[model samples]
Target: MLDQTILSILKEQDQQLFDLVLREETRQHEQIRLIPSENYASPAVKAALATSFTNKYGEGYPGRRYYQGQVNTDALELMVIERAKALFGYPHANVQALSGAPANLGVYTAFLKPFEGKIMAMRLDHGGHLTHGSPVSVTGQWFEILSYGCNENDVLDYEEIRRQALEFKPDVLVCGYTAYPRLIDFEKFGEIAREVGAISLADVSHIAGLIAGGAHPSPWPHMDVVTFTTHKTLRGPRAAIILAKDADMMDRIDKAVFPGLQGGPHFNTIAAIGVALGEAASPAFKDYSHQVVANAKKLGEELKVRGHHVVSGGTENHLLLLDVRKSHKLPGKRVAVALEEVGIVLNFNTVPNASDRQKPLFPDGIRLGTPSITTRGMKETDMVRLASLIDRTINNLKTGKISEGESAWKDDDEAVTIAAAVRELATSFPTFAW
Candidate 1:
């Protein structure tokens, strides 16, 4: 939350933007946000974002900056880099990539030529990110892409992955995801990349906080290069990090990020990243991370018990993908919208194609997680309650109490009752309890 003084400044300078921020804050306080990629940065992290460091521009690495007034910026960034390396157990790191996409591009530029290099990655529809060579991104347009996907049951088929790796011999083996809800076998990915002589890069944007808190396994010791965003599970600022196993790899990625992709770093964000790293290093954060997974698993279990079609059967991480088409006989967008009206917020997504042929838009699946709610100090019992609300919302939709389209479920007695229940549950905790 912004301090009163900062809110006053915002209100004075830009009333419209301030109002939007206020409305959003109110909405967050009233809704159960389940978007896996979204979380509330701690007050310290948010405060760091509003610092005077935002005024400076440090154009290069610590010692060799292109700007003159970089003493403070350099120290802050260097400290953040060291924190990242230490926390992630890596030898070298570049904390300058603007965000995850540019971070991955930095890695690509470090090793691959524009048209000649091949990147082997998980298919986008199967949980891969855009920067991992989805056809819509620059990563796919310039470079050759070989994609692997889950099996008939929406599970990763590692044997098929190995077969593809042997067949393609890609320059980079990419193993990370946006929506896959199971634990990644980083060791197996490492073996495949090593056997194929490809550089291994893991993007842990979704679970960097979990890895930091030891809820999930680290990608290092298995990956040659690793990239992650600070804002996601890490509960930091909106920036990204690239870690390399050795100096040679580090040098290439650093040069690629500095002189190749990005310009001056966001110093405020770097400072906040340091703050978040310090916070994440605490014992409480470890407990919060474990609870995040517990909540997700319990949520999946509850949903499954209610006869929901949970993708991959269940989750081992902080997220669950549901085929709403199977359960409610409704499109995921309809369910997502209807649920949001009831104060439970999540996103519609593409389930693995095994169950249905769904595209990115109007997909039949919904993706949600427990990170934000867990950060708000929610637990398994709360997840059970949420599942019940979700079931009620779906049932309401079926009976025409919940409206479709870009409309809220207002003007109905039952809808109002469910919404009141949601608000009661949502307002019970502070925005960032953990």
Candidate 2:
């Protein structure tokens, strides 16, 4: 919880934003956040955000900043860059990019050219993200985008991926996702990219912590460039970074992040990222990462025990994608809303080859992760209870009592009762608020 003085200052300075803050705190306390892309930052990271560093305009990298007041900010930047390189085993790293999407865009700008080449990545419905070449995104509109997907058995088809790379002959090959639940074969992906004379770029934005904690394999030596958000499983502030394996790539990447894209960087966020990188290097962070995977696996098992279908049969990582159509004849969007009403938080996503009947499946599969819960000190037992809550919410949706427009789950007495029970369960595992 924030100090009373700060809360009072916020209320006096801006009542509207203060109200929103209170609402957010209430929401966090009442619900279990399972969104794979979301997590709570540590007190150190939060403090960095509210520091005077935010007031400084450090336009460029450390010593080369375009503005003054960067002496200490420069030190923080250099330290963060070094820590990131050490953590990920990269020869060089740029911690200035604002977020994952922007960091990826910087890579594209630095390594690729418009219309001169194509980029290959996994299909969006197959658990890849927008930056992975969704047609609507600038990455697709500017450069020719070729996509690969999981096989009929729901596993990444490396052979087919190689075939696509050969056919497309793209300049870059991307291996990453926003909702994928299986372990990635970075070495194999590297081999495929090399076979077709393409540079491999792995975006570990969703699983960086897992990689750092040794829960997932590192893609550094295999991929020429790697990019990721500092949040997610890393449990840091909202920022981004690009790591290059060679000095030649480093210069291009730095240029791309500066004149090619964003202006003055947010040194405060970078400072927070530095703190997080240090934290990730700790033994406790390693244990937390392992626990995240353990919790996700436990949650998936519990859901499957209750007759729910988990994509890939089970998860080996921090996140899981649920096929809502199995338990109830409902879409991902509906189940997500119902779950929200009942104090459970998650997202609806698309399964590979989800039918047009489930069109616009951005709201298709419910994507949830265990990073925050694990951070909250909840383990496998809590995961089982959370799964039960999700099951009950889905069952409630089956009753056809939940309309799309209903504002609050509490409006329905039975739903409210279930939500109360869920709240009570969450209260038992109260998150660290300081």
Candidate 3:
């Protein structure tokens, strides 16, 4: 458990901030958190964030530091790097990136000159993340981007992706995704990148834990560069790590992360990441990873049986996109709001082939996953019950029982009934502390 001494001190110094923190903690304990990218860090990982290392400024790599007081910082960073490399089987690891976007930007800086190279990546709506090639991101702003999309059935068309890579001959070919539920074919991606004379980069930010625990295939020995966030599924602090197979590429990435992109590394977060990597390398975490997938499969199956349109028919991993507009005649945003009123948390997402008539602010799909719930120790049977609750909530919304708008649902009788039942169920399966 976390040491409550600091929290007690904070409560005495700033009652208002302490109250807000308590309320947020209560909300987390009471809600069914289905967000795919979210998880509860273990007590050790949390404690590492509050350590004395946070006060130091570690500007460079171990043994090559620009600062004087880095003896302890260097030891912590080297442990983190070695743990990450051992877990992922990578030859080199850089643990200084603040988050996923910076890690990706570092890769670009190491390999390609600004405006002198091109990138081929998956389309955003089809499952790619914003950093991949979205026009709104710095990556798209600085480089020429060619994007490929999934087929009508919501599966990656590798043949078409290969064709695009061959035609464009981009400087880099990137794979992996944010909302994709199926296993990625990293071998094919590497083959295409090789044929086109482009570097292959796999952004396995969402599935890093699964890879570490042997629940999913790894991109190693095939991909030249890989990036992942420690917080999502990995259940660590909010930081990112980059790994590479070649020594030259590793040196380039290290320089890019230090002087090219960011300054001093956050030693506190790096220590927390080391704690998470240690946990991930354990046998227990492997069981947790397998159970996460099993719970997701059961939840998707139950939702499909209830007549919901699960994108791509079902999920093979941690998340599934529920197309509420197609089956329930309700906007995804509307359904998401109603679920939240009942203490079921998820986000509205854009499904493949979403029509322009459906506004971007209110897309046609809701993305739900089993990571957080699985972390709470819920299993397949629990997933069935939760799916039933979700079905009842949506049915009430489709009818006139729960009001159509977001705010009006709070006062409706059916919504209140559902919320009470949700609270009861949530209390039964208390979240784990460590």
Model-by-model lDDT, in order? 0.89, 0.85, 0.89
Please name the candidate that would achieve the greatest lDDT relative to the true structure: 1
Worst 10 residues of 1 by lDDT: 399-408
- Model 1 residue 384 distance off true place after TM-score fit, in angstroms: 1.2
What digit string (tens of lDDT, one per residue) describes model 1 on residues 57-86? 878888898889877887898899889889
Candidate 2, which ten residues in sequence have the lowest lDDT sum? 402-411
- Which candidate would rank higher by lDDT, 2 or 3? 3
lDDT, ranked from best to worst: 1, 3, 2
Question: After TM-score superposition, what is the CA distance of residue 407 in candidate 3 from its true location, in Å?
Answer: 6.2
Q: What does candidate 2 score on TM? A: 0.95
Candidate 1: give the clashing pairs.
Answer: none
Clash pairs of candidate 2? 349-365
Give me candidate 1's TM-score against the actual structure: 0.96
Candidate 2 lDDT over 213-304, as tens digits, reads: 99999996898899999999998999998999889898999999997899988978988998899889999889988999999999999999
| Angstrom error at residue 53, model 1 | 0.8
Off by over 4 Å in 3: 398-411
What's the number of clashes in each of the models? Answer: 0, 1, 0
